[model samples]
Target chain A: MEIVRIIVLALAGLLGGVFGGMGMGGGTILIPLLTIFGGVPQHAAQAVNLVSFVPMAAGAIILHIRNKLIRFKGALYIIIPAALSSAGASLLAGLTEADVLKRAFGGFMILLALYSFWSEFFSQKARKAKLPAHDAPTV
Target chain B: MNGIAKKIILLACGLVIGFINGFFGGGGGLITVPVLERVAGLKTKSAHATAILIILPITVASAVIYIIAGKFDFGYGLPAGLGVIAGGVLGAAALSKLSNKLIRVAFAAIMLAAGIKLLFF
Candidate 1:
């Protein structure tokens, strides 16, 4: 039984890591699996996801650096503020209502997904057709 | 934009991304990549790479806070982290073979599915 549980968690981690290495956040998949399938509480699940993310992200970051993919100068501009804000926000999250946070996160995810799909597919097609998209920035 | 102005904007963007990452556990890349490309003038590949680097520190900071606050559970997190490390290596290697369009599509699909699951169930 213990081995089975370990295998399940490991598999989930592998799935999350694959996505994380692809520049997608691992916690997106990890958190849900932990909470729903592993029977971990929501807050604890999120915490575990965040904790696991560090090493997974570190592994990916090293690879990206070795590949000369990272833009250090540009990254520096973002990192300081990001680190500071993340510390502040995380503390706030610990205090906020869990249900409210979960719902808000869900809404945010849906909106982000729709926007990403539109930008990747519809906007790209418009660009190929030489038509201007109102808000889509060609990246 | 001037160099200083651009730096400021990037910093502000970072603040927003970090806050979201802290509030949620993941999903920072969804915003990071676009901002890097559209606002910072990075190419798509560069944006993706830079986003990972950008996320590393923010995630570390948030993780630390979660740990200090007694939110983290190492029993499960440790095994999962180890697995993720292995998977990260494989995924990075696969990047050379996989097309960017395919990755984008897969990412979108996953995000959509996750979103629906969270919202409805």
Candidate 2:
């Protein structure tokens, strides 16, 4: 069981790195594996997932930056509020019920998968709904 | 998915993953691993380890913020982080040889299974 846990956790990290490189949350993979396969508690699994994410995000961000795909303006706009919320939420998660959180987390994943499925399989609708092009007017 | 299409899907997933990471602290792995394996055709181990490597930056940055704000618990984080580093390296090596489809299928099945388990079991 220990060996299995190690292998699974390691495999989770590897998957996190590769998919993370292509721009995705490896946690979506890691937490479930940790909880179900590795027999870890939900809180511990979530914490581990967050800790593991540090390196993975760094590598992917560097790649995106190297490719000139990162927009600092956009990143900042998003990161500030997110950072604050995450910190606040992390604390809240500690007080929250574990099973409730897990179910909530599962619901979140379901929504995300549904969104991904919709975007991938029915992209015509997305394109039609895409934000319209806007040009800044010169003063 | 075709190469261009796959990339597009990955990017879309990336945006969602990024938002979740920024707001939730961990989402990329949960989100990306399956996409890379199922949509982008990456091997499972490769996809998993790669997810960790990629998550490092964002999480580190977030960790920094947390640390600065006195939210970090080094006693807990440091010991586990050592394990993560070792695990990360092993996972990366394993990924190099696995088949893509197996990776994707394994990822998807785990996700659905976990989701179901969490919901009812």
Candidate 3:
């Protein structure tokens, strides 16, 4: 039983890391897997996801850097503000209710999924038709 | 907009991305990539790559907070993290071979499924 649990967690992490290294946020999938399938509490799941993300990102970043894919100037612009906000928000998360956080996360994921679909399917075509010579910016 | 103003706006957007990361543990890239592409004038792949760098510091900061707050569990987290590292290497290698459009479709499908499960069941 103990080994089973460890295996499950490791599998979940593997899935998360795969997507995460692809530049998609793995926690979007990992948190849900941990809470719903792994029987971890929501807050603990989030904590674990965050902690695990460090190694995953580190691994991916090394490859990206070697490939010269990272935009250092842009990254520097975002890092300081983002790091500060992340710290502040984490403290807030620690205080929030688990159920509420879960629901909110669910809603956010649904919206993101819908937006991704739209952008990929309809929006991409529309943008290409409108600007044949240039790739329009996406958001 | 001017260069400095554009950068400032990007920084502000980072704050929002960071907040989301801290609150949710991950998902900052969803916002980061698009914003970088649209606001920072990066190519899609570059935006994706840069998002990883942007999230690294935020994740570290959030993880530290979780650790300090006694929310992080090392025993479970360590093994999972090891798995993640291995997976990350594989994914990074595969990225060069995969189509971006295909990746986007897969990402949407996974997020949709995960979202529905979380919301309904």
Docking class of 3: medium
What is the DockQ score, from 0 to 1, of model 2?
0.14
Clash pairs, model 3 backbone: none
State the lDDT of candidate 2 residue by residue for B19-98, as single tens digits: 56644457645555554445544444455444544445556655555455444444334444555555545554565577
Angstrom error of the Cα, residue B26, model 2: value is: 1.6
Q: Positional deviation of B89 in candidate 2, in angstroms?
A: 9.0
lDDT of each model, Cα atoms only?
0.76, 0.54, 0.80
Report lDDT (Cα) of residue A12, candidate 2: 54
Residue A82 Cα positional deviation in candidate 3, in Å, after optimal superposition:
1.4
What is the C-alpha interface RMSD of model 2?
Answer: 8.2
For candidate 1, lDDT tens digit of each residue in B1-121?
A: 6777887888899899989888887778779988887677776777777787788788888888888988887778877778778877777778688897888677777767767777777
Residue-by-residue lDDT tens digits, candidate 3, A21-103: 66677778888877777777778888888888776677678877898877776567788899999999999999998888888
Q: Pick out the ten consecutive residues of candidate 3 chain A with the lowest summed lDDT.
A: A130-139
Q: Per-residue lDDT for B12 in model 2?
A: 61
Q: Across residues B3-121, which tens digit of lDDT does each residue of candidate 3 receive? A: 77888898899889999999987789789988877777777778777888888888899988988988888667876777777777777678789997898788888778877877776
Candidate 3 residue B113 C-alpha distance from true site, Å: 2.3
Give the total clashing residue pairs for model 2: 51
Each model's interface RMSD (Å)? 4.1, 8.2, 3.0
Candidates 1 and 2 compared: the better one by DockQ is 1
> Which runs in model 2 stand beyond 4 Å of their true positions?
A128-139, B1-25, B28-110
TM-score of candidate 1 to 2 decimals: 0.86
